[model samples]
Target chain A: MVQPGSIVGGLLGFLGKLGASVYFLGEILRQSGIGIARPRLVVEQIHNAGVLSLVIIMTSGLFVGMVLGLQGVDALSRLRQEDILGASVALVLLKELGPVVTALLFAGRAGTALASEIGLMRATDQLSAMEVMAIDPVRRIVAPRFLGGAISLPLLTGVFNVVGILGAWFIGVYVLGVDNGAFWSQMQEYVDPEDIWEGIFKSAAFGVAASLIAVFEGYNAVPTAEGVGLATTRTVVTTSIVILMLDYVITAALL
Target chain B: MDNLIEIKNLHFKRADRPIFAGLDLDIPRGKVTAIMGPSGTGKTTLLRMITGQLRAGQGSVRIADGDGMTDIGTLDRDAIYRLRRRMGMLFQNSALLTDLDVFENVAFPLREITDLPDRLIRPIVLMKLEAVGLRGAAGLMPSELSGGMGRRVAMARALVMDPELLLYDEPFSGLDPISLGVILRLIRETNDVLGLTSIVVSHDVEEIARLADYCYVIAEGRAIAHGPPAELARSESDLVRQFMAGAADGPVPFHYPAGDFARDLAGD
Candidate 1:
């Protein structure tokens, strides 16, 4: 049984270690020339990370848009701001809601998988094997994943935005008998390309943060099943925190 | 005779706890030097330090000058990587990449480090796989392999680079007798055929006695005895005698205390 102060100290130590790990990863990337070499691998990783994540992202997007449309239409109908329905949906999906929700979904699905896969590699000494063969594990393993996430996030966010808006449009205009032209016209007037850009930027940043956290946790995992589980849990939690923080910052800047 | 690897007064510490202190050794070219020790005597650490995986605190490790006899410790990250290409290591576990099949696992280093075409790469990978008797397992994933087969696949991967130096960390740990014989014979044949310098860290005394041209007995963070296996067999040192004979009642006692024994007996 650890003392309460010791627990707090342990938490602080964990945070410090995480910070150092991120710094070390940055150094590895710089040293390995990951930004330049292995472009094809990065593309492959992006396809895997972003495209493979689409089914879940789309599913979540559709349901979320439906729920928001139902609730917002119900509340706004009483206030007689029903003409602002498309603008409200567009605002929520473009600036704040879509990226955050997609990131949370990604953290649960792809993020955990990345952590477990890398953790297993570490546990099995495959990473050490790469070092002995003179192959840079960072370039071969980590860089691809990082690049994949960076590329995938914006693309996935775009998918979320399109799908989400369509779902909201169906609910607002077709299902609820709201004026279709007014909703789209207001959306076209109010929602700039910069709004979409902000959401994408936030999503991309979240993707990079999530990938970094997952890979770091996996690479540093202790040699046990429990350690892999712990790394997965930490990856999800840390990615969620980062996504929420970035969501606020991006929203404030854009709005 | 040229020494393939030379270590002068190597020292290492982990978190300020001394793992090795002032260790010196030489691995001659074209020979197998077996490191025999009980567990936790820095055998693995010594191997890791030699291969540049871990850095030594206070010593110089130099490889032969055939391709620039660089001091391993002074090399930059790129140089270190290039230097590592000249050495091969078979880890305690097979350590085959789970994401790759057998052929791809063997071909991984070549693919990453060289621009060899598929026509060139396929034959080379197949040849290596055939050497380890795993050519048929080329398409199989690592999960499909038995323990011995996994080790063989790892051996193929290690040897694909045609390295000058080979390090085997407890290669005989989890093998059946037939598999052990095959592995031992392969190691001997591979070293002789390629003239590869080899260092095998093992606790398998019988295997070391049979195979090692020269042997070092490590205990208590030091090489307690070092010589030909025959010479070490005749030593009067109690530590060497106890280790060679596999006695539990020697200078190295069991780690458990009397209180633990009493507790075990009382079922507490």
Candidate 2:
């Protein structure tokens, strides 16, 4: 049996990190007031966090949609509803898979990059250099990167949803012999505007959470090679867990 | 001599290990003051305190701001930043922003602090780079520069603001002999020509001897010796002698303190 003392220790450690993360968020919000005034910095990070992750995100979306298409055809053929495969694929992409998978892939690619880059900066004293130069590192560095990731994820989720629907379309209508008209029409009838909005809202929230964790881990990293590696690992782990938890909560409430 | 900085009864600790205890030192205006110590003796920490990067747990650090001495610990964040604007620090790693090229790195402070037109800012940045003898390397990225070149670019960045106080942390460490000679000359020339006070944290006794007007050698949480480099070179203190002469062993032991070496080796 697990010891009670160990359980309490784990709980306390988690709570400590949670508290520190909240304080970090407050600092980012405060600094972002200044950071937003400098559009160029935020735009540069958008390219780092959003634009660079395009290949992996699109590739993963296509494969995931193709898999879903295969499964939906096999399952729906028993009920003679394979014609509605497009509706199932679109609804899944927008309501669940689109935002969820995009965020997971983002944590793997962009989140680790943000964490390691800033962690390396800290290790090499770039952040301290800024402080000595009278530049607030949070305002000048962290906030812009945070804002960039927060802006990019939702947009990436939109792209993922579109690509995923098209992937399913190719497989279901062309390869599997489902009627193309029935496939698209069924999707238009079933997938509501509310479903699309739900995906958008979820993606936005996950973006903020992922960006916050990455920056917080990086900013507070122990200034060593080993420490930076750990922070990068923690960024991906914490972001993936938070995205899943947030997805569940948002889905329950919206449904 | 008019002092540019004063530390009074300063006390600081890192996780129960006392880094500075009742330490006091002064930096004279318009001179290069070298801080010398063995590794891990908090030379860099002292510089951090002077810049308000790290606060003392007790006592005060007062830096001359205009005509008044502002107690660094008493100031708010905005006030500290205002004080820091008049200061510049060259980190041990050179700390050039990797994303920017040489010209932009030198131009960073000016662009951030002032809305100077590009036409005006360009000349000022080029002039500082020219002073550091890197005017032609302006377009190169930081990765393209040699170690000496990187340090020179960082020095130009430090001087671009025309700061009242400049701090160099281990400026001579890992430099080739030619780079060391260039930095030694720059430190002296920069202080004299610009009328700026400099506090250099280094263990390079030869370079400090050539560049500093006065020097402080700190150890065991306090300044153990302070005098002109010539005076320190002639000191009787065993620890100071060990440090100045670059001896391998003396008052600062060569071996780590431990139980019997034989017993430890035998896993007893």
Among residues 3 or more apart in sequence or in different chains, the pairs in candidate 1 whose N, CA or C atoms overlap within 3 Å are none
lDDT score at residue B92, model 1, on the 0-100 scale: 91
DockQ scores of all models, one per candidate: 0.89, 0.84
Stretches of model 1 off by over 4 angstroms after superposition: A1-15, A28-36, B67-69, B257-268
For the second chain, the TM-scores of the candidates in order are: 0.93, 0.98
Clashing pairs in 2: none
Give one digit per residue, the lDDT tens place, for model 2 in B153-183. 9999999888999999999999999999998
lDDT at position B201, candidate 1: 96
lDDT of each: 0.85, 0.92
Give the CAPRI rating of model 1: high
| Model 2's TM-score against the true structure | 0.97
